[model samples]
Target: MLGTVEERVQSCPECGEEIRTDHRFVPWCAACDWNVDPGEPEEPGGRLEALRRRLAREHGERLLAEVTTDEALRPRRDAASVLALALASAVHGFTVALFVGGVLLVVLGWGGALPVLGALCLPIAWLLRPRFSRLPEDEQVLYRSDAPELFALIDEIGGAVGTTGVHAVAVNGETNASVSTYGLRRRRLLTIGLGLWEMLTAGQRIALLGHELGHYAGGDTRHGLVIGNALGSLRTWLYLLSRIESPTAPEAVLNAFYLLPRGAVLGAAMALDHLTLRATQRGEYLADSFAARCGSTEAAVGLMDALMVSGSADVTLLRESNALRGHRGAAGEAESGLWDRLAAHTESIPASEYERQRRRGALRGHSVDSTHPPTHLRRSRLLAVAALPAAVTVDAARGSAVRTELSGARKLVARRILNGG
Candidate 1:
């Protein structure tokens, strides 16, 4: 809370329109939306992106139509999932073959003629091995000892979602949240962006948790190490090969060596993504269903609403960052309540603004990105059916304790954001 902010009436400085706001919040004319940006309009990524958007829109519309008649409860699979599984397995098998081939070449070449070839295989095998994530250096890591109440709430939500809770949590000053595995042990980590987390209500927070964890419950093969690492390795190969531009005669000769391999890798990467794209989309929808189950339909819808406004929140951050430049002056302070202002920015948006965003989303084929289904379709699916009560709840006491636990980290994040880090 921004300490019980009181409404003050005023005229918009730009449009001279009537406006209202509190001390911590910026006043903007409803007509002009001077500072309130739900987000900037999305730029088309390219031709492939346009095609993906069209496909996603069509698929999402069909799925929403399906959800209207079908009860939205447990997730279901389809033929696309089967195809995706087959393709994922094939990629993993190929990686395993690379290891076996490399090992055998080295072993056989120990006393054989192809010693040079065998040595080459070893590097290739190691290069393409399945890899997982590493803990982020930029984000603050939280342990159970560091924030017991927060982890307890996470545990409760995980249990509600039917997966073990995260082994650790990391907080950063971005507008995103994600679940990823780190280290050789592959222990689960939940990364929460305080920028987004700070703006959400308790219910919306639950929905966020459920949606990320739901990726687990839905068995998101796209995210699993099998397909994830395989596609990742292929991408790495593509990146490396792409850098070999033929600027000189010698470079051209060398580039020719990798040209065929790059094309092959690109084709392989596209196939993997193409085969799995639908399944990935399905996993997202399933995750949202889990979100609805754990956070209740109303809150899940609010979560979608939050995502829709994320770009604006990003703009708010920049706006605040620039606003602080004169005062902070090359040295940012941790004491400035940048987050309180961010939270207030969200608070200042009314229901009518949200409604306008929803309408715009339909015309825009609103999506979080190219990977997921359109937000308008996702929201419509939720609204098409009646929602059960939230399975997990964080009452006021729990919420307060969690906030208290995060107080230090929140201050650190605020300092980082204001400092232009």
Candidate 2:
């Protein structure tokens, strides 16, 4: 998902105002007291199951066909490639034009009526430029020499995928693994979730790493950076415009004139972004296929199942955070027991029932802004790939050593989380 569940916003059809409702099924607008169909409240599990069945009936056949057809599965870079270059050029050109135009207007002393207006606007654009700066590394723990095992695994996965190794690796508290770029250089950073590592088997772990590494091999991260920065610039520009304080009527009128064109430009950027969403989704499928090649189909499937099973990590963390209140130093110790608690909870649920829930969860689909395809769609695509030879198994000793290394990393992560870093 693009954001937290609580962060999901809905627009009221009647008022066209954003509404923050407690329940998704019952979207009630706080502004106009607008209610959407006011149907009987359905249990979360029942809703998920219904969604799963509905999606299967609607999109299952088409998804299966797309996955099975080799041509359909191929990643088409022509559109995304062109769009990325065009977007980068447009943003750079616009900024440069703003600065140059401002300088010329000031130097020529043209239009006393609009004296230095361009010069004044230039500073605003430059000030807002920081907001479009390259994404920073958000992980609390930066695992370089500290996590040699992970670096080695990343290198191995990079070799398997025929790409240069990652620049750095880090761990987070989430239940997902992702590859991202930082700064203008677009240096790669691979982030793995401690919770996900605790849940997956050795083969599944390999598959997960392979999936992330596949993004680099497929150029998804590079293209994504272009789109991401463009969107970021648009958002920052919008935010700066919105925050412009119009203390007087004249200032309000002036701000409105300034914002009007920028707003149109923002709208155009959004439309361009929408056009590339399909390419982003296809990149995900390509990555899945790459993972299937690196690891066996079984390993890829296992990784997907593990993802479904452990998707509740957010909820678990929330509960743990509450429980950790007033127990400051003991947070790391509390965290150490989380995996065991989760394992026990999983065991308490019957295997058949767990599978059913997992299948249902997969059908709920991802949020609109998510770049990855829905879990159900990805799972289907993996199933369509022809079976490959078994992946090489890690030796028991090596496996044990990797787990030991991960365990150490987990403690560090736990400490970081507890200390509120």
Candidate 3:
């Protein structure tokens, strides 16, 4: 009896075909017609199908709530931010003083000290800076109370698109989303805000997610991370030092004394930042195309419209909220002024709609919960993508029960992953 039981466990349940335990970690029981780790609890009406439906519903709600609520998606590292600032500040102060003093010394007959001081600061800057720290894991950075379904979606799309599974999905209350890679192994992170979830249509959401995944799959995120970190350090150092030194110094004197080496750093940093930002924007366009090929166009359009509406709505909400709270910031006021000036220059939207959008856009400063290009711009880009002929199309006639089952199962897992399971 013991020998028979062991044999049964190893055999395929359906055809009695030997259940090949492939070393690649794929546990497919051909006889039983099942995967080894069929993720999620099975439900009736075909367990995987039912799970997919549940996930879709949950994903919709999460999108809505994430945008409307005030929740911290990632842990705030005051210490890290402070350390970064201090690193820049310290380097700037020392460099400025050295350059100025060196020039003054050269004029005062003490030139040899300049080279010694310059040599010393270079090593100190390298030593004092932080080492590569892995960003907090996906689970730690995000909170997903209703994550099962989003995980399901990610699995479905990522599998079809040949991208790594999403490592994290998070929402801050803003009309934006971003994907990033950090550290040695370059783990991928998928970040969405409450604003984005609530604002985009389901199809649009998928498209956006696809775009983020494209970055992960294409290795753009990792490149961006390295460039961003390197440029950020140099930018900070240069900006701080430039501010500390007086501008009245002659251009030749300034470059020779304070600017020559630092200017090179500044230029390089600017180029990196610009390139990184441009790459992200371009990734959005490709993802738009990717999602269109894989899924429903209606869903894609819905996502874009949702984003636009929500963004317009949030601006109005913010202005009112700020007034109610009786808080006014200089930068916020300046931003509002800029918007007002732009609004004046543009063709007028309807009064009611205009007021509504203004209120939503007014919610705090750009730094608060804002990132990404404005909704109108993104919407225009999506529409352009939609106009393109799709590279691949799903064949309804060829779709099999097995394929449906696979899609359903994948969806469930992706949703769970996204929701932070």
Candidate 4:
């Protein structure tokens, strides 16, 4: 255990204001935010950054206006959506054609018709085969039977929105949570990150789940079989033709030969991404609406606020994980207070800090990531919607049981973090 903590006063170099900082908390001028995010003082690439922000901000604003007026985020067969599907179909057809051609040539070659041609085509066809997502063989997964209380909550939330139910839940040590599909059946999988989950309120947790599961109801075109697989195939091609950062003489020749095809694939990928951009963004907003409906508007808004502060959570987690790893390095066994310390640190954060993070998000025109609308806009839209009480709730007893069920997952994740594997 450490000694009694005391507050320290320091002058803010930029704003020249006295700031009180504690060892337990990150110190920065609440007034000017000096020394906070020093490395990322500004967004990189002056003019390009400005243009990107300007364009993104304008696009976000326009989308906000459209949604405000429409507010109907159902799957629509719009022109762009149709075009994307057509492109995806064409891409898939090309792959199938390659496969058929390769197999036919191989058969002919075996029959002593065209052996060399058959041999070359067979390799090409095999390489161009349709790729499918597979569940990671090593990643840990929790079935409903393993955690009934948690699955109950998840089921309730799914019913509140509109999902059959997730196939399983996977826990990770990252600062984000997401839902994914696996296999030909497209079995739903929910992965909740401890770093973000620990920082949330019970209600915010519901909102997070609602938002994720909402994607199923929201018709995320990018995740559809046609568009998604096509995008995957294009990515595979790009990967195969990708240039080496440093190349020897023969490798240089290969790179030069691959350049044109690489450029074409890159351009196609960009275009496909653009085609699905609006639909995906719409899906995200609708998901937020689902969050509001299931977890209440306030909880949904709070979840968005929590997302903005995830960077701070990430930084603190890095510090804590490094310290924890160092402790393990020095001792035979180390006590794990990783989650406890993270929760405490987040709880200790002042409202002022969250407000500052929100302001920074607005200035940066930040979305959850590059794929969604700006955070501020999302919050605004959530507020604009009619308020509703939570459709699903986890009482203290159930919540406790849920946590207990997650104990094993916590150990696995903590091991993953400290070991840095």
Task: Please tell me which predicted candidate would have the highest lDDT against the true structure.
Answer: 4
Model 1 stretches astray by more than 4 angstroms: 1-54, 103-113, 243-261, 329-336, 366-368
Clashes of 1: 0
> What is the per-residue lDDT of model 1 for residues 223-338, given as tens digits with 9 covering 90 to 100?
77777887777766776677454369888887888888877776676666666777777777778888888999999998898877776688878766666676866334424567
Give the poorly placed runs of model 3, Cα more than 4 Å off: 1-124, 127-146, 182-184, 221-223, 245-256, 270-280, 316-381, 384-421
Which is the winner by TM-score between candidate 3 and candidate 4?
4
User: Candidate 3 residues 1-421, lDDT tens each?
Assistant: 0011111235655566675342312345533444533443324343222433443333433332332242222112234334443444544555456556555554555556765665565554554343454554432254223454456567677765577666655444445666765557656666665435433434455666765666565445314443345544565556544634444557546656665667666554444433344333344445554555445545555555454445343553354344434333433443333323223322222333333332333321121211133343344444543243323333443233323333433333323322323
Per-candidate clash tally:
0, 0, 46, 0
Error of 4 at 9 (Å): 4.6
TM-score of each: 0.82, 0.73, 0.46, 0.84
List residue ranges in candidate 2 displaced over 4 A.
Answer: 1-64, 71-75, 106-115, 127-144, 221-225, 243-263, 326-333, 343-349, 352-363, 366-370, 390-392, 418-421
When summed lDDT is taken over every stretch of 10 residues in candidate 1, the lowest stretch is: 328-337
Model 4, 378: alpha-carbon shift in Å?
2.2
Who wins the TM-score comparison? 4
Write the number of the candidate with greater TM-score, choosing between 1 and 4: 4
Q: After superposition, how far is residue 30 of candidate 4 from its true place, in Å?
A: 5.9
